[model samples]
Target: MSLGDDHGYGDSARTDASGEYGGTGTTRTRLPESGPYGGARRGRSSSRSLVTVVGVVVLLIAAIAFANRGDGDSGGAPDTADKPDTAPTAASGTDPVKSSTAGVPTGYSQSEQGAQSAATNYAVALGSTGMFRKADRHALLDALFTRDAAARLKGPMDQAYSTGFLDSMGLDENGDPPEGSTFVSRVSPMGTTVEEYTDTTAKVAVWYVGLIGMSGERSTDPVTSTWKTWTFDLSWTDGDWKIVEDAQTDGPAPVPGDDRAATSDEISKAIEEYGGFTYAR
Candidate 1:
């Protein structure tokens, strides 16, 4: 295929239909929610990388549990005040961190510690490798966010995963690489602060850096980029850090440093070799 073969999602579906996640070949499974599921799902961004912060709807949807995310530096935040110029990571938790993730709270609590833990974990889930998989997308969405928001967000996501977009990353149709590539997408939370909170309503921001691209392959966009600190104005909803509405501006972006780029083999191996974690505030 030529470099600019217009593989954009506007083109036809090239379902690799293979039996892998990040490997070559398209694959589709008949979920219980199958049939005519796709046509309606076409409008969402369809991005398999870290889901981009799409819009403001996330604000209302994620407001259920912000009450306990702890307040800002002085202990609580006034949602309307001019926020800090920038937020750095936090010190260790002074409060307890308990989370009952899915039936099992898993020790998640509702204090500054709890909020931090929740934010960290949610950020990881929100910024995971699963965002790319069609089969796993809904589950991750349902798990981390409110159902209402998930419903509306899905279609836009599908569209975002257009063929041209995937090709741009040197992948075939299903957001995967040939035999020797590693598509890497990860989000590391530098720290988080609850800008505002009131019982069932709260606003939290997670500042982070994400890594996206084919680590080592025939890719022009190496699996390397340093975006500005990403902030999520998340809400506490349906028992999780559901991002109701969020926005991002450029960095506390660090100056370009002297870290050597990993070789394609190193990147691919690392992608497969390294495991991801569920972050908490």
Candidate 2:
């Protein structure tokens, strides 16, 4: 499964995602520039109006570019990585994958189990709320993505968290609470497997789900769920599956059940009142 196949907004196609920078549509019209002396005045007015439109377009382009800059990269379906220098030398490199509930990884490794462990754990971290905060986002990319990719991602990711994005989700321009609303964005890994592996690199597939959107009465689209498979093209840069690139797309999704959806208030309270988990497998 490719990373683009993910289920949440992170998913390339199947998920419902909107970044703060760009409004959902992309169509645009050009402004009139010819002078209107008789038509001169008319022309000037048209030009000014068009100029204003151009300005909005420029801002939109910049915003979308910034907001959508994330880790998912492409290099075809995951293939095996380069060979390691030493023969499985008594299980070296980083500590074992740490766990919180049962599937989360605190820190993981490169062994078979370790690969799966790392993928699952990393998925949770990559999909969590931390990816939105500057300090937390930095901590996560450094901890999860490949060093080079992480460096490229830092600034763009920050810009993507624009005030407009917050407003779209019914959040304050800073993604903080408005006294009553709660923001909900989370990921939970279900299973994992090493799609590609070698001593120097490993491609791990993490199948999981995510919950997103505003959590209050004001939200038009309340929280929703999606399933996706995120494939990581990791290089053993330092140690671990330091993601060089990744991609996402829709499920492997199961058909929907006939269950009643939660109320906006219920969802809000759950998000505001509840906390997320620390995973390990």
lDDT of 2 by residue, 61-168 (tens): 999989987677754566657954323323334456544322234445556656655666676666665555566667776666655555655554455444654455
Among all windows of 10 consecutive residues in model 2, the one with the lowest summed lDDT is: 29-38
Question: What does candidate 1 score on TM?
Answer: 0.60
Number of the top TM-score candidate? 2
Error of 1 at 226 (Å): 1.5
All models: lDDT?
0.47, 0.52
RMSD of 2: 19.7
The lDDT, on a scale of 0 to 1, for candidate 1 is: 0.47
Off by over 4 Å in 2: 1-106, 272-281
Q: Which candidate is the best by lDDT?
A: 2
* Candidate 1 residue runs with Cα over 4 Å from true position: 1-108
